[model samples]
Target chain A: MMLLKSESLPIVSEQDIVRARQVARQWAIDLNFKLIDQTKFVTAVSELARNTLIYGRGGFMLLEAVEKDLRKGLRAVFEDRGPGIPDIEEALKDGFSTGNSLGLGLPGAKRLSNEFEIISQPGEGTRVTIARWT
Target chain B: MERIPILRMGDFLLVTIQVDMHDRLAMTLQDDLTRQIVASNSRGVLIDISSLEMIDSFIGRMLSNISLMSNVLAAQTVVVGMQPAVAITLVELGMSMPGVRTALNVEKGMMLLRECLDSDDSEVEDDAS
Candidate 1:
């Protein structure tokens, strides 16, 4: 397994969210992921990117392409310096929402990827890294 | 704020989404659809999402909200032409859009709406202004 070439982009605005999704999709396509897998990854990127902007108040995302035993995957890291989640457990709940949303963002993104991780501090910030295998 | 256009045909309203759905755009669409439904007295609303390949939980909530609002205003909402991948992603997202209706395409959606309106004529008549 190896971490291949990667690209980073700021997630301060709505357009950045779209940019992340597009870049992730292109990478997934280049890696020869299935159409459904591409869509899954793109959707996950969209959700997490939005969370970074709205909840995290702005962040950065890294699109990293990786390989394990010759199998390829795309990894995205969304990091923000905004107010972090106090309760990771509650935030992952399907119907829980703090911002007038469906509360599906975190969990849904988790479902759409093969690997998901989150690190946050109440006063510091939050960072979520997700990876999807091709 | 980008606006998604709403077209009226007889007693039905048609909306074809062709752009990236940012949060602001989704909110705007929800508000616009409500206003259009009220103004046109539309009995059915059709949303074509075949062109939209990606979506998130926020958009999912907005779709559900639109369905709920249309119901309150005496109109039926049908979301049609969802891409297969989008369908799989939505199901995995766990936001099944509980109260919203769906169809494979615009033609089938209109048929479904017509059937619903015909079968529930009395309810439509009683509630619709």
Candidate 2:
């Protein structure tokens, strides 16, 4: 994958979540993603960005436009230096949340993306990367 | 500190969500709507979400919360004008919004609220007899 362009946005406050969604939507539109695809990608960004703020204790989101295998895609990486997850599998389950939310952020975001990846450790931190292709 | 406005219209409260709501704003709207419903003695609440291009679980929960809260305050809530893309995304995100009532647009939502209120009034009258 080759990075064509990229930008980073903070996820310290609730307003940042909305900004993340807007940035994702614009990137999806630029990629010529279908309306539904754009909505799906942006919704995924909202979920992950919130997790980065609430669960991760404030992080930054890295947005990237990339080209891979002759296909264009938008990638977002949310990284936080908070208490990490001990059980990655459990954290990815629907309705499994420790933040008093609906517990759909991780799983829902994974479902909405073409590719999803996560890395976490008990005392370290967590990083989630999601990408959607047009 | 931005807040969504709730307008009172003849026994109903009208809310048009024209901005991309942050979490705090969504919660604030929920609080304001419930308060307005009681203060105005509204029989129904119509929420227009046509301008919202996205509906994450947070906003979905906020809508459901508003509906549930209004019901407790003797007011029926009907969500309206959800974009097709948003509807599709909400469903796929594992949020069916089970107890929340929805309509195609503002006009239909108003009609549905009126019907619901009418039915409730008739039921109350029936119980009184």
Candidate 3:
């Protein structure tokens, strides 16, 4: 696996979430990803970015383009220093939102990506990474 | 500062969401639509989302909210022109968007709204008679 390109954008406000989605869409398109793939990736980014802003109490998103064995991929990592999830298992469950949302962010993002990962520590922060390969 | 515009079309209120709405913008649209439905005394609401590339859970919930609120205000809400990819993504996101009626396009949505509104009005007329 090799990183070809990378960029970081702040996720402190609602507008940042929209920017995150647009950046993800552009990255997917640049990788020649199909329309469906682009939409799915962008939607996943929207969910995770919102989570980073609302749950993570504002953070940043890292976008990376990677090449692995001639296969290209796009990866996004959301990092936040807000109060971390106390129960990762429960939080991942659909309809289990601590906030008033529909509680689909974590699980939905996982479904939309080819690869998904989460790391969180109470009172510390949380980080979520997702990738889709072509 | 940008807000989604709502247009009056006969007994219906039409909103074409042409922007990639941020969270606050989506919420503001919801609020604005709800108020407009009452002020216009609209019998139906048609929302065109064909320009939207994606509908995350937040936006999906907002759409559902708009549908429900419109119903409570004695209006029928029809969301139309959802991209196939967005539809697939919404379902995969675990949001079926229950309680929200959808149409294939603006034309179909308008027809459905008119059909439902007509039936509703006739039902009220029968009660009055």
Candidate 4:
């Protein structure tokens, strides 16, 4: 079993979201994720990164590789200290969004990954974790 | 989340895409349109993207996917009204949208679709005779 870890530099803009996705793609490829799986992983990361910038103002992303029950996968955790989600349930709804455009950020990220978890509080902040197994 | 109407004119389905189209809901719109084109076996499709402020690689890929999928279902897909900035970004990103037709505006896109449909009908007629 092998474990790989990396931390993203703090980013606060939309362009950084794109850069974060590029970093995530490289990591996925280095870990031998299938092409389609890599695309899914990148898409999920893009959504989260965009959210971090649009909603949280700025944040850091952590990438980790894990092995469990003979299965290997990639996991990402995005942490932001912004105005936390006031309502988690509402945020998870398919069409629920506080931004312009379609409200598919959270739900779409959830749909693209194997596992997704979001923990947030009104005053504290928001943490989003997602995993995709190949 | 605003539900943009799918405008139907003749055999073509026209959809106007707005800004912030990189979001997941926009991707879902692509999926929905693909399904619609397949199930209905439409003759043509024109997606107006004039309102989009930016187009990322993912959204470009989705548009390409829709174009390819529509072709398999015997439909022609055209993308119209791409902002210059969006176009430059797509090119800079080295994004290639194969099998997708692009036009400057909806009017031009409609004209191109008409020509494609006309040629297709002629082919069918020739095959029948």
Candidate 5:
């Protein structure tokens, strides 16, 4: 997808996740996506945003409006400088939790987007990128 | 702190989550519902998420907590008004939200709560035997 515009929000607090969902929903609507699609984006942002705040030990999210093959969509990249995941595959398991949660982290967000990717280092941090096309 | 309003409807407490629920708000709802259920001695709770566009893992767990808590308090909880899209997203997200009773709308949700209350009564009858 070709980038239209991008903005970043800090994910250090729970309030940030709320703001991320709001911004993602507005972006999805601006792209003329349907309600369900917008909801999907908002929900995915909530999940990843939480991961960034809790697991990442504080990070930021980059929101991008993009166009792909003449279709508009939204992309979000969450980056955090915390203890990175030791095992990406196990983290994606449906009921897996490294902490106290449902553990529907990476997998759930991946399902909501048209494109999803994650990059992480053992002690550095983690970055997850996801995009949805209408 | 913005509180999501909870309305009392006879033996049922009605909570319409009309905000973009964050973690704190979801937790607050869980606490408030627990207190109201006990204080009012209500038999059922109907949580309306029609206006809610999203339910993350934290909020999803809060919903389940409310159900389990109300059950222990001798009250049944019914979640309703989940948008078609939200349901699809939850399923795709792999939450499935086991043990959380749901219905299409508020009216139907009340009906489900009543059914549970009826079953509770039947159980009491069996205990009397």
Candidate 6:
């Protein structure tokens, strides 16, 4: 299994989203991921980064290339210590957002990835993990 | 978060959107553009995308939707001055922005919009006669 990783910088602002996507794109290219898979990775990364800035006060993201049973894939984890999500289920629903959001960030991220999971507790924090196979 | 209306040339209205075009703002822009096209019964509209740094799939879909909505309102929509990097990202994401004409600069975009508007006017005149 080939492994690669990156930690999100503290400059977690909306503008940083573009930089995060660039990193993800480079990682995908290095992994020799398929074009479609690369797109999914970039899109998922963008959404997560945006979430980190918008919802999660600030946080870090880790990305890794994984291989299991001869199948290649990628995994990403975004963790934040911001005001945690009070309701995970409602958050997953499209158009359900706490901020003045279109509510497409989480749901759209889920649609772009093959696997998605979220862990959050009120006043604690939120962590989101997503994976997609190439 | 300030939307600055930079110019209005003939049937085209050019504005600079200086905030993240996500969430409610994105929706608002789409709705407003659609309404403007319908109200004016414009032949064509041009939107300047120079100040926009990033556009996610949602925004891309909205742009396409706006274009289609304009058509339904009997108008054409064109997007101008998208950065190359943003374009590359959009392409990689498999976003097919439909019904929108893309141009390299505002001048070129305005030229196209004018031509579309002129042709539309001629057609309307022909029908009237």
DockQ of each: 0.82, 0.93, 0.92, 0.06, 0.83, 0.17
Predictions in order: lDDT? 0.91, 0.94, 0.93, 0.77, 0.89, 0.74
Candidate 3 segments whose C-alpha is farther than 4 A from its true place: none
Model 2: runs farther than 4 Å from truth? none
Pairs that collide, model 3: none
Chain A of model 1, TM-score against the native?
0.98
TM-score of each: 0.95, 0.98, 0.98, 0.57, 0.95, 0.63
The full ranking of all candidates by DockQ, starting with the best, is 2, 3, 5, 1, 6, 4
Candidate 3 structure quality by residue, lDDT tens digits, A14-128: 9899899999999999999998889989999999999999999999999999999899999999999999999999999988999899899999999999999999999999999
For model 6, the superposed segments whose C-alpha errors exceed 4 Å read A1-8, B1-58, B61-76, B79-129
Error of 5 at A1 (Å): 4.4
Residue A51, candidate 3: alpha-carbon lDDT: 94
Q: What is the interface RMSD of candidate 2, in Å?
A: 0.5
List model 5 lDDT by residue over B1-129, tens digit each. 789888998999999888887788788889988999999999999999998888877888899899999989989889999888888888888888788999999999998888888888999999999
Interface RMSD, candidate 6? Answer: 5.8
Q: Write the per-residue lDDT of candidate 2 for residues B1-129, one digit (tens) a residue.
A: 689989889988899999999988899999899889888899899999999999999999999999999989988999999999999999999999999999999999999998997898899999999
CA deviation > 4 Å runs, candidate 4: B1-129
Report the error of model 2 at residue B18, Å. 0.5
Cα lDDT tens digits for candidate 1, A1-134: 79888999999998898888889889999999999999999999999999999999999998999999889999999999989999999999888879977788999999888999999999899999999998
Candidate 1: list runs displaced more than 4 Å. B122-129
Fraction of the reference Cα-Cα interface contacts (below 8 Å) that each candidate reproduces: 0.93, 0.96, 0.93, 0.00, 0.89, 0.04
TM-score of chain A in every predicted structure: 0.98, 0.98, 0.98, 0.92, 0.97, 0.90
Q: How do the residues A90-114 of candidate 4 rate in per-residue lDDT, one tens digit apiece? A: 9987657787634667876787789
RMSD of each: 2.2, 0.8, 0.9, 12.1, 1.4, 6.4
Q: Weakest 10 consecutive residues, lDDT, candidate 5 chain A?
A: A90-99
Model 3 chain B scores worst on lDDT over the 10 consecutive residues at: B113-122
Residue A114, candidate 1: Cα error in Å is: 0.7
- Considering only chain B, report the TM-score of model 2: 0.97
lDDT of 6 by residue, A1-134 (tens): 66545454442665566667777777777778776667667877887877887789878787777776686777888888999998889988876778865676787788778889999998988999998887
lDDT of 6 at A81: 91
lDDT of 3 at B27: 94
